[model samples]
Target: MFLRFGFVVGQAGIIGTMAIVLFSNAITLLTTLSLSAIATNTKVEGGGAYFLISRSLGAEFGGAIGLVFFAAQALSVAMYVIGFTEALVGYLPDGTSPTLVASLTNIAVFGCVAIGAAWTMKLQFLILAAVLFALFSFYAGAWTQFDAGIFLQNTGSGFSGGESFWTVFALFFPAVTGIMAGANMSGDLRNPARSIPLGTLAAVFVTGLIYISEAILIGGCRDRETLITNNLVLSDIAVMPALIAAGVFAATISSALGSMMGAPRILQSLARDRLFRWLQPLGIGSGANSEPRRAIFVTFLISQAGILLADLNTIAPLITMAFLVTYGLLNLATFYESITKNPSYRPRFKFCHWTTSLAGAIGCGIVMLLIDWQWAFVAISLFAALHWYLSKIDLSADFGNVTSGLLFERTRKNLLKLEGELYHPKNWRPFVLALSGTGFSRPHLVVFGHWLTSRTGILTLGQVIQGELDDRHRRRISQERMLHAMIGEHGLNAFPAVVVASDYVTGVEALVQCQGLGRLRPNAVLLGCPLSVDRMKIFGGLLRNLRGLSRSAVVLRRTDEPADDWKPPSGTVDVWWRGRANGELMVLLAHLLLQNEDWRGRELRLLRVVDNEAGIDEVRNHLNGLLKAARIPGVTKVVVSKDPELAIQTTSRNAAMVFLGMQPPNIGDEEAFFYRTEKLAGGLSRVVFVQSAGGMRLES
Candidate 1:
């Protein structure tokens, strides 16, 4: 208040400066309330704001903001030390350098913090008493000098220094940013959740009243020229100038000590999480209470760098930008927690609403830009880069975060909305259920299903654990995890579903019927081509059941090539257009496959075999027209042959994958149908026998 209050009053005048103070404090108060809500909801530990944010927002978000917040706190030490130097410089000998004074002040603060938070906190009481005494003296002296005419004159803004309202706002925002100082000391507190909200809120209210009263009193008593030219006007207006000087020393040093203590704890928390390898050494605590001595040394070095900058205003905006970023993210985290309605987010502090958090976030962002757009851009960009880097590290948190809850809420709403919309062929997307057992065992089946979906649709890797639910419940869970790990290992965009039943057939049936939710339910079922005759019979039965349920089925017959040699298919995808019943679905699936990066440049060939050459031209023309109508890139071929299966083998021998239309066998002819499919897929690299159960279309 002593350092920048006069500057703000000078630039924005009495009313404008008071308004900025009120606005900044109001935003701070709302943010504090949001912090209170989150703090009360969980068991907050040592890291204070960092702990709360990381626990609520997940590791990546928390880690990134944690580092940024640490930087803000470390630099704040320099800002406050510079303020202390400014106050002490007036009493120093002639020609004493302000930078030298700032350096010394920083060292003193470092020494105080090095002694530990207990000793530093003990000093805060004396500092608070001095500050209160200073405020009393200033108000007492200001009342004697106050005149109605001067008060009226200073009420409106007079921009003589070419300073804007936002610039002044930036100077004053740091005063309220200290509300988190107590939160940063959460580790040292007896009960963080209870202490943080009450203590921090009370500090905000009391300080806000003090700041507003001081602004009004100073502006009413002092002339504009004096306010603008003098950075130490408070001392001149005090009943005892020496008391005001003591207050300046006390307030700035107290803030510097607070930052010095808080920043290291934040760094220590980050190091403890092992987010960055180099920070691991700093994670080690020195004593019984786990003091962050190493982190303190690092923070001291950063503060010394900040103090070297020498000017309070220069360091002030940088600290403001960092704090705004941290505060804005905190608001967003709280807003997500509330909006998602996560049951675990129940807070004893109910005064905060989601809208308040939203408003606080938006207000912080707007203030950041208003103060300095270039700085805000740099700050936001740096934050984004850090977030991206942390996300890439794949950090995991032990506690639940709002990200999953937010996604689940959004998915729930979209699913319900989709449930109400009428289905249309034009809007159709393949929702595939790949019954690939453990997925790792039949990697080809899972990979093919993912390629078929192409991320525009949903692909679920389903496993059927054969046993009773009570007997194999744990196995089902383990297999589900394995399926998910398989998807991650293969880098496939898919979901996993595992079920336990008495037998393979029952498990498959259960998966087919209950794999997805609402409109997101699977429309296509993919399974590997059975190797044995008995398994083929079961596969045939499954196919019949799927057709009866109007679900398209894809049977993948992989070659005997070694798994090491197997890779994403790269050559042509041949589609044998036997009839519209399966041809359309086959064409659509091929198009979807080509959408994936693995099959991005692969060719699509639509082929048909005619018994004779009499109508070959007509067949070719129809295929070309179909491709044109479908707006899919592919070549057309018409082959004249007596045997259709032989023609397919001869034409697509070297193709990457073959898509053929198939019909389910009659009730007692599963053996014959299986033999025919085996013959058709003979010597093929990969064959996918597709049977459409109607409703699928290529052209709407």
Candidate 2:
């Protein structure tokens, strides 16, 4: 397909193809660096394209771009499938055309490939090998017909303009588009930090070498003018039309598969964020790679749709636009990180000066804007829409999976806060949120408490691995490997830096206390309840002592709904609200209403008060006054009463929930008292508690 569609770089000269390679290489490098910054700070998940960008940038922004990327790939894949199959059918009896057969065959191929990894892997390998071989052979053919003089003869490509040289760059730009095939696989690779950057760099260099050599070879053709003007496949000179067309067929197939593979990952990433519910079924929160079965299927269907919409002629422009959009963002991300002096960010790999990348991106964006204004407009419009959606969206509820790394665009500030290096007025480690043990709940608990304070914390997972090493180097490495694999596989790439400490370590007291750690402030430490009694006692004592050393905090308890979904009584989102230590919970009703999308951006009214007696009349009178304040003619009001029993009555009288605070027990038995609270509110209404314990300790 490369040869047929004029993707083969011999369509131009060495300089022309080299230009494309340079741009692709630079763009790929920028993207890799951005992704690396995100990966180092957060664990990567299945949404290969969406994962890194969202983490580095923010999920909302990431989700928006993810949707666009997914759409582009889906469309590109269909184009490839339809085009390739149609060509395959051309080999049938002279009297018959095989387009329909090709479509059916391609659909079967899609089903078989998407159904399982084994088949997909096998097909990918075969396609890759065939294309690699064809590319090699084609380059070899070009060398056999090398022409240095021809390069100089038509360097202008017959375009009579002072900017003719740049015209050549424009003509060969589409060739650079294929480099995304390698870049898009960042999340799938075993070692993305190392392999993603290396593979992309290698792909760029090799592609450049092949393209430049081919350009020189084909440029020197005996009838260079004919090849340039007629747009004929390079093989017209060699007379082996069969072999050349066959090679084209292979390359096109490879391109299509590559596009298909890439698109779904981006879609899957978006779905992971719950941005595109339609695609969520594909990567549906399961499988090793979070395969996103439903998302992949939707992508495949979308691709087929695109294929139907576009024929051989119109598809090229859209695909080019997609590539340009990605490249432009890549350069922009690199530039931002570079100027900001972001940690671990380096521009060393960029092929040219920073200005060059900016220039290239601008050029690409301009060309795209000029070619298909409507499509470009649609893509940009959707991206902006998505970013706005992300900007306001909060993912604290899914706190475990989100890395603090994405919290800010500028990096240096975050590095200090994340690494536990910052100092408050009463500084030490700001607050030690001990991730008590290894379990599904650990990351969320630790990150949450950490968020509450400086996030200078640790999460200890007492995992039952197949080993018996005690803080041994090998054990640590093994754990890291396991964690890396599990984290990536589980798509928890966006997580804080976790140090898997030994459970056998006799005392976590010193570590938890941040004892004698010089200026490294460790205030109060948080611990979970699942540990052995003896262990908790020891850790609890240490926590108390640490408080003496520094004003420490301890919110020790188990979740009432440990492994269950939590729905607080309406806008009562359990906010440790920034301004007010505990803000009005009545707005929770607004939040509940906002969940319906149709009324999200509306004004809200909430009922708030302070009570000491917890009396029924006091609550009802206060609630009634609050309800009066909420009278907005057409708007709705939901009140979650402060008293559980009264709240239940209110719910029956009018839709409402019972909101209550966790009352620390000193007068009565602790367990019995909390258990009574649970029993009391069990069925009255959506009884809720502010999660003061299991969350990232807020820095402020």
Candidate 3:
């Protein structure tokens, strides 16, 4: 405050400086309230703000901001010490170097912090006394120099030296950035949720009033030229000039000490989480209170680098950007907690609302870009890189975070909205549920389902356990987890579901009837062809049941090739167009498959088998017109064959994948239908028998 007040007033004038202070303070207060809300909602421990954030936002975000916050705190030590050095140099003997003074001041702060937080608190009381006395002296003596004309002249902006309103704001924002000082000491405080809010709010309010009052008084009493050029004008206006000097030293030293005490604790908390292996040793604490001595040493080195820069204005903006980024994320965390309405997020503090937190977040971001777009970009890039790096590291936490809750809430709302919308063929997308029993045993079924959906729609890998729900509930959960792990291992975008019933067929029926939410439920079911006669009968029965439920069925008949040697085929996808009943779904599924990277650039062929050659030209013209109208690229072929099934197998024998139309078996003719399907797909590489429920259209 002592160092930058003149710069802000000189650049933006009195009214602009007051506006900056009020705007910054209001946003800072909102962010503080957000912090208080989160802190009170849970049991906050060591790591202060980092603890609250990591536990709320999850590890990646928390760890990223913790590192940034730690750097800000370390740089803050240099900024404050430099302020103290600036005041001290004015009173020192001629030729005294400010760099040497700043280095010595940093060493002094390090020694005080190393002793422990207890001693630092004791020193803070004496420093506070000096600051208050200095304020009293300035106000008491400024009345004699106050003039109406000078006050009016300083009220409007009189910017000079290439300094705009935002430039001045960048220099002054650090004044209000100390709101998190209390939150950073969360580990050392008793009942932190209570003390942090009460103390931080009070400090912001009181200090904000003091800054506004000082700006008003200084503007009225000091001339524009003097205020613009003089960094130590406060001392000139004070009745006891020496007391003002004492206040500058006291205030700056107190701030440096606070940062010195806070930075190491944040680092220690970050290390204790063991997110990064290199930082593990810093987590080791010594003495009765377990002081972060190693972290302190690291902070000291970083501060020395900041001190080497030596200019307060240059260092101030860097600190401003870091603090703003941290503050914005804090508000965002709180806003998500509130918006998601997670039951566990019940905070004792009620004054804060989601809008306030959102505004605070947005306000911080706008200020960041307004100050310096280039530096803001760099700071944001660094933050994103850290978050990405931390996300890649496998750090598990026992406690729950809000990310899942947020996703659930959003999904719920969208599902409800979808339930109200009208369904149309133009918007049709496959929501496939693949009943692949232990996907590892029938990998072809899972792979086929993935190719059909491939991120354009939803895929759920479903498993059926033939047992009573009471006996298989735990096993069902375990199976579901296994399926989820399988999806992750194979890098497939899908969900997992498991159902238990009294019989295999009954379990499959249950999964078909209930597996999704609202209108987002599965529209198609995929199954692997049975290898045994008994299983083939069951598959025929399932196909009939699916037809009655108005659901499409895709049955995959894999070759005798081993699953481990199976790879996505690079040849053409052949679709045998028998009729519109299953032809549209076959064509659409082929299109979707081609959208995937593995199937990209592969050929698609639409082949039709007719009994005579007389209608071949007419059939070719019809297929070409359909392809042009649908905007789907494919080759058309017309064949005259008395046995259509034989022609299909012979033509697509070397195809990557073949799509064929099928009809559900009559109740008593299941065995006959199974044999026919087995013969039709006899020598094909991989065959998909699609039975569409007539709910989709490719040309729409």
For candidate 2, the TM-score is 0.54
Q: Which is better, 1 or 2, measured by lDDT?
A: 1
- What are the per-residue Cα lDDT tens digits for candidate 2 across 429-540? 2234344343345554443342333222222322332234455546556654665564566443123223333442323443544432233333434444322444444444
- The TM-score obtained by model 1 is 0.61
Best by lDDT: 3
lDDT of 1 by residue, 521-610 (tens): 788999888877777787888888888877899988887565553367557999999889999999988878877777778899999999
Q: Ten-residue segment with the worst summed lDDT in candidate 1?
A: 418-427
State in Å the error of residue 358, model 1. Answer: 0.2
lDDT value, candidate 3, whole model: 0.84
How much RMSD separates candidate 2 from the native structure? Answer: 22.5
Candidate 2's C-alpha runs over 4 A off are 4-17, 36-41, 93-102, 147-151, 160-171, 182-187, 229-232, 237-241, 277-279, 285-290, 330-374, 390-700
Error of 1 at 432 (Å): 23
Select the stronger candidate by TM-score from 1 and 2. 1
Return the TM-score for candidate 3, rounded to 2 decimals.
0.60
Error of 3 at 373 (Å): 1.1
